[model samples]
Target: MAKGKGKTKGNGRSKQSPQNPPPPSQCETLEEDEIIRCGEPAADGPRCKVHQAQYRTLYAKYKAAGKVVDETKAGMEMPSKEHIAQYSNLHSTLEKARRIRKYLEAIRVEKAGRDMHQKRFFAKADDGHKIRLKVLEKQMSAAVEILDAVQARAFDLHMADDPAREWVKNFQAAPLSTNDEEFFSAINSLESETDPQRDIMKQQRVAAAATTNDDTMDADLIDIEMRAKKASLLYVFEFVTSEEATLQCMREFLGPENANIGAKSSLSYHTLCQYYRRIVMHDPVLSLKAINKRRMHVQFEVLMDKRMDFGLLLWKDSIIEAMAITRSKAGTAANVGDPKNRFKVLGGWVFNTPHSGTMSNETWGTLLETLAPIEANIENRFVRLCNTFDDLITYLSFGALGLFPPPRFCSKTDAQGRDAVAPRNHLSLCGCSVNYNFLYLGHHPLRDEAGPQGASYGLKWRNGLTYLELFEMSPMHLQMHSYPDSGQDLIYFQVVLYSDTDSKDKFECFGSGNEALPAIQTRTFEGPPASVTNLPSGRGEWEVQLSASDLLFGTKQPEPGYLTLLTRPGSSGWFFHFKKMPVKYFVILDTVPHRHHSILAKHVAWTALCTHGFGEGEYSNRKYARASDVMFQKRAEELLSWKPKGSWTATKMGD
Candidate 1:
């Protein structure tokens, strides 16, 4: 009976029950006017999936437009005219604020460029230019203030929670302080609405996707290739000898024509070696022995009673050679034998060396003391000096050094004795170069023909004074000089010291009691009753005195120390360090103009003094010096000894 009841599967159709619902037929979406319904077949909801998605999009649009949606009819209400107007006004206000901020940023960037130009060129802004800049800054400030006010108003009206709104709220609440740091920090902390959006996560994902396995493998292969190249016998040989590399570098420096000339003559290698020797000799630190050998000549006076210094001799020779070259090119009949020509030649050398170019004021004074008296004919000597100086400048421009003469020096007397005007195409040397004029040293201030109009320049020199001399002079005195154009003088001395070992502290009472401190100390001395003394020279000399206690470490004897003499004439000054200070008294003599020559000379001299002992002293006995040399030699030999059939060995080379 049960089997008969189960077998009643007539037509294979199920009844429309609660569990087995009937399939949907038509979509339940209404039109915009809510007059017609969408009659599309529904796949999963009251409407078809496509119609359901469109309904959700409309709902979102209505919500964003601040309008209510009628869910029963699936329709959105139209916005009022007043609401549309308000939305437009808000959008326009935000856009205006953003534009104002952008314009202000552009102005700031332009102002920064102008400021940099002024600083770089040492150019002062005119009154009108300064006023215009101030006006621009004020206008930008006003625009920013207006934008901030507008943003505040928008926040108040809308009461919306956004980055911009929140920033405005915090900005208004922040306290105004006189402290610039606090005020700036508060402003920086506030987020800007117009800032560019940064999608860091998306960027990181994109970068990761771009770096494929092939790219990684390529980078690894490149690294492997480089290592293999470095380990090759050919590379090892090139690195060790470097003859071809040196020749190539010299060829690059000398130009192709010059290099080819040397190569044709079979002197390329010899020329390169000569160049290497000259460079090594010119080196201030490495060529201490060479400098010392020259110094011995000075002590012995091997050439004459008053032979020129090594640099001066080299300069004289170079000038003579330059003159010869000039004469050959011009086909001039004049010889160096004539008295006038001889005087001119001497004057040229005098003007150019130890005074012209970048020579130091101190060196200039020393040179003048020796050569000024040689000009016996005072009347015509000045004229001859000018003529020769002009000639030397011309030679330098076209010959060695390739210096550009100033405009004032370009004016000359023609063969007919008439004033000859030359083209003023070249830029004059700056104030720094002209400052070294020998005529400005008070001896002949009126003779400064190269000096630029309305440009003020001065020079100062300080002698290397010893510790004993410094100790003897007490209660240091400084003469207060008034500079109408420049700012007040900031004169102070700084003493810096470092201990060789940690056990001996260079500084005492660095921190609180029993605190371990670093073995370095710096002390600045300024004002009266501390570093200066009353021992004044007749020429308004300001004396600076330092006692043994002031400079020394406790009761320790006088050890090797460097003394830096810094004498500034106009705001900025340069210092030269003396390894051994032995002058009786420190002298700050005011003079006029010089440039880079003396600074370089002093640097070289100091380097020579500091490094000369290392070659023959106990320090050279250290293991690193000899051991490193042997290790390098052995490594080179091993690399060179490599063969196609032999196994590598790590045998040490004997000393």
Candidate 2:
């Protein structure tokens, strides 16, 4: 019996040994994959050692929340109340962020639409419109700030493995919901218990409870509160610089006498300076100098290097003195009702004319007599006092000598000088490349009342015969000739057609003969001077050339016979008037060898050609119309290559 018992005990020991172990107990705790239970051996509770500790933690959370967790029935897979709360909070935050983001996006779309509409129609928004837009912009900025904070909070609370936390992770990875209906639908589904289709909503009532809690805190006011809290130095700066604040301060500084000065009223720089000294400089929180220094330091960090001792901080008196100097430099005399007083207040130093004392009484009287009409029309008395009348006469004389005449077109002729008739229209004529160079001299006959009526000298004045006579003469010969005896001094001017041809022929022609041409036929003057030897010659000459294409067919065509008047002194009065003459016959010569001359010619030509015609009911051909001489000259000068005021090397060497 002892031997039989020993064999049984050996078999039992063998069954319990490692190689032949009995069935092990499995943990009832769920795995991270929820569907799979923990396969490790059960320890303290119905879970592995790790999950047993988790269940204790969860049970403790329930106890803290005043809920009894039956320790016997508590499962390790059940989430703690704290985790559930955190998950709810995270979901609420993410939803709030999404709503705020969508709201901001809607605001952006609206603003963009407004901007696009305004741009398309060239419409300007009124003050009320502008204010509304600014308010919306501030709201957007505030919304963005709130959204950022909410997203940060969501990220912090989104560490759990709950559905809410999972939703937050997906929200972070996905783009903000742009569709309003979709976003609202999602929120509604999450909040309502009636929706059984959503797996996340079916899990628990935590999200719904969180949604109810969110209603108590107005999300709309969150941005406003955040904006109020973030009012810092930058906000203070902006407030001080605001138009209303600046105007209010100005009004106060000006005292009760200037209280009527509204926003639209012009404020003088001196007044602004006074306000700055009295209010801004003395303010406890802000200093202009300090602000400027800080701004500079922020912009250029190298300026703040320890080794560099930049004397950015200056004495208050020095700053005040600098401001005073700026105010003085920028000062302008107030409008005076009295003309003489206005002139005296605004006039600079004046010097007497070179012939002031030397001229005869009669000559000076004639000059002054001639200037009476000019001075009477001048609005600025200071200009009249500054020898502006003399300057006017001198400028008109010089400009007339340099005036470029308008182009005049002629029928294209074959190699044998036979006229070739082609279909003629503005486009067809302007497109023709064939062109000829000719000198044009314009003359206005002196009135019979002023001088003896001279004979026509065998020239037909109606057929532009005088122009033909001038065209036949070489440029050198024309340059040597004097002014026409019968011509008015003010109306006489000369122009030369610019050409690149160096062939023996002085009149260079451009393009092939087969091109379409204008219909106008011209004939040179078929008369002669009574005595060619006695004709006026050897007068000062200045040549101006115009391209036919630019004068007639450019973006802005000069009006036919459009005459510009000289209202201002030192104006390009004659040039402006000459360029708009009805004469035709000119074309562009692109292959010209002298590029600079060609460019200068085109620049001057275009400047005159592009002058805006007087508006409807305005007299463009009036004798005293206003013309911008400075504008014309400025345009011409701009075409030339830019040159430094002084040699760069010499400037660097302090020469």
Candidate 3:
């Protein structure tokens, strides 16, 4: 009976294993609290369990004793000496470590609190600007908390129909009240939920583009290299040097906006990007090799001809450079009733004789005498300043290479030319690839005059998208604004782009002009891209050459004409007697197709793996600054040779 009792207790009653002890009997009890306090196993527990809680409390005490967990969760997690030993032997004295940890924990707590406080303060103070935690952890925590609350409340917001959506439906800032007397207030910009349908469509399109073939990219590059020189010849410009590195600057030049460019350029980065994306999604093939890089630094110098090997001499060299001429009344010269300062344009600069010919002091003097009568005060003065005008001078000759022009389409014809392009009609498109590009330098501008009659040049000019009329030997009348404006100042100028030829060609003016004679210049001084000369190089006779400033045979006329004048000096004087003769103006007089019109039309075209405009039929159409910046990420040409073998480099998480 005794043996049976022991067997039942050990096997049936408890089933105790060799490494285990028998279960506690009903009559027996344990002091779990005492067991933990003694640094022993829990009185009763499932092996891995810490049921007593005393050990846990004691275990963390090491770090607490070290003074690590005085403030933050992170502080509490700081390992004790025992933990450090886990990594590798620290071999430091325990007491010293404890002291150091204590100090570190104090700093951590103080910094966390300070950061949190700063975030709230900044958020409240800023007028709608978003503040991100640059280096403060406490601030980020506070911001995260606020974001959480905002998001929760945001979802509960009602639809436009709901009455609870009072603020959103009636979306208006409260008027200043006499009692409240509040001067200003800011409100959050409400955003509606995105359409799932649109999201799905976007995903499908992206997937489709990913799978599409991209043979065009290779063809385009190969064609560009082989034909780069040929196109320059048609414009009478010789192919000079080429630089691949210069073409890469488009990365920074990127912005999100497709350049809606209103008469007044008042738009934020976000808005600009939105607008740009609607039309311009991608960049085009650009080459910036020909432009002088140091021209801006060396405003005056002399250069030698590469072909002729002669000194490009300088005779005063006052080439008319009319880019950013400030128009001014010298202080309210106009509207004497309210005489305020007026900033106006002086006009584009001319090289030698303004056109391409030699203008001696005497011949130029007579010409200026004729021009001054029809000129504004500023322009007349500007013209007189050109007594020593000459193109013989160049910065390149005098060891001053100016800032190179931004990457531009250093175009050359393919085997075929723009004219050689096959018409799209009859379901067969032209194999000839002809392209035209313009750098619409989007400069910020402001108009001070409340209701003045005068007009500003860059402030208001035709920004065409299509190459409907790229070549400009003829005079085409263009209104100052995109959409025609009514009333007052009418602009008319006799534009002799260059005497390339064809006196029979008449300029058909486009955009706002009420006069019966809608045409402007009576010439089509062809400044076609180098593409014209890049025809098939059959045998030795077909070498490719292209240039913007290429000199053609038998004609001293500049292919693009002289430094053409969009306007002369910002003159305050006004003359109703319209006349723009002798003073040649080079206005971009064609409407180019927007990105949307082109991109969507070629729905089946496969885009290359390359970013930006390296892909085929690439549309640089962007709407915001951020989007444009993002598009520029993979702009390298070597993308063709790259493989996706490695993962993205690790980046710091956004605080």
Supply the global lDDT for candidate 3.
Answer: 0.23
Per-prediction TM-score: 0.15, 0.17, 0.16
**Per-residue lDDT of model 2, residues 152-254, tens digit only:** 4554454455333443333234222223334334434433533343334223323332232212222222222223322321222221235464454455555
Per-residue lDDT tens digits for candidate 1, residues 239-278, read 1134454455445555565624333222323222222222
Query: CA lDDT of 55 in candidate 2?
Result: 45
In candidate 2, residue 562 scores what lDDT? 14
Name the lDDT value of residue 494 in candidate 3: 21
* Candidate 1 segments exceeding 4 Å error: 1-260, 263-655
lDDT for model 1 comes to 0.29
Itemize residue pairs with steric clashes in candidate 1. 358-597, 435-593, 435-594, 436-593, 436-594, 475-532, 475-533, 476-532, 476-533, 477-533
- Which candidate's lDDT is highest? 2
Given candidate 3, what's the lDDT at residue 256?
Answer: 31
